[model samples]
Target: MPITTSSPPIRQPCPPGTCICNRDALLDNPAADPRILLLTQHEEKRLLARLENCASLDDLRKLQQRMEQQLGLRTEITPGHNEVRSMRGIRIVVHEQDGLCRKIRQSIPAAIRRGLERNPEVAYELLNEHDLLRGT
Candidate 1:
């Protein structure tokens, strides 16, 4: 005997009134505005901590539910809002910006070297001195 496999059948998207397929339609629609994740700085930090500490798939799922609850609370607090909405896409913008900042910071050392080439003594003095008057 030989085992055989078959792919699932492709089905048409559900009609607008019949199911929640309208949301999918909205996503595909060009006129709909791009969605933004509404998490605050504190919320984003906590969510990152939760995600980092998630040990298993089940733990991750629970964290997801908590995030959903937070989103629901936000929605209740700020009804009739056009821009802010919730989705599973969070932490991405923060991470991207962090990476950009890191790159900028890394280039600063090279910039300091260039400044030193122009005037070595003043640049070295500035780099070496730190908070002498601050009692550190």
Candidate 2:
């Protein structure tokens, strides 16, 4: 018989955010107010590193404030419309019936679910690729 070898497993694109890797993590929580914030891998890493190196309570508070702005929550609520702030803090108003917001909400959860099924080893690979893991 001729000797044959299987090809290596195909790599997937890097997923955003921390994945809920196991059933235990999925079953462990019942939040009072359930919400999802979808962030990319780099964004999550930056958030974690910043949290670790916070200089003082004041720094921590400032960090929180900055995060709120970054998350697009630092906006005035006007009734009956969806309001988004531009980079220059100008308000861009859109109707509540806009499909873009709905699509965003739906897509994020789907992406997270896809992330849940990713191979566990991929996490290590991600850390390695980003140089977050060092010294073996």
- Per-prediction TM-score, please? 0.26, 0.28
Error of 1 at 10 (Å): 42
lDDT digits (tens) for residues 1-136 of candidate 1: 9998984332233444544324354446676532222343354455555554544434544654564464421111111123212221111221121112233223323332343344444332332343222442
Off by over 4 Å in 2: 1-38, 72-136
Q: How do the residues 1-136 of candidate 2 rate in per-residue lDDT, one tens digit apiece?
A: 9999985332122233433222233225554111123334455556556644544434544755674555432212121223222222212232221111333333333332233224323334433444545678
Candidate 1, pairs of clashing residues: none
Best by TM-score: 2
- Decoy 2 TM-score against native: 0.28
TM-score of 1: 0.26
**How does each model score on lDDT?**
0.35, 0.35
Q: Give candidate 2's whole-model lDDT.
A: 0.35
Off by over 4 Å in 1: 1-38, 72-136
Residue 126 Cα positional deviation in candidate 1, in Å, after optimal superposition: 53
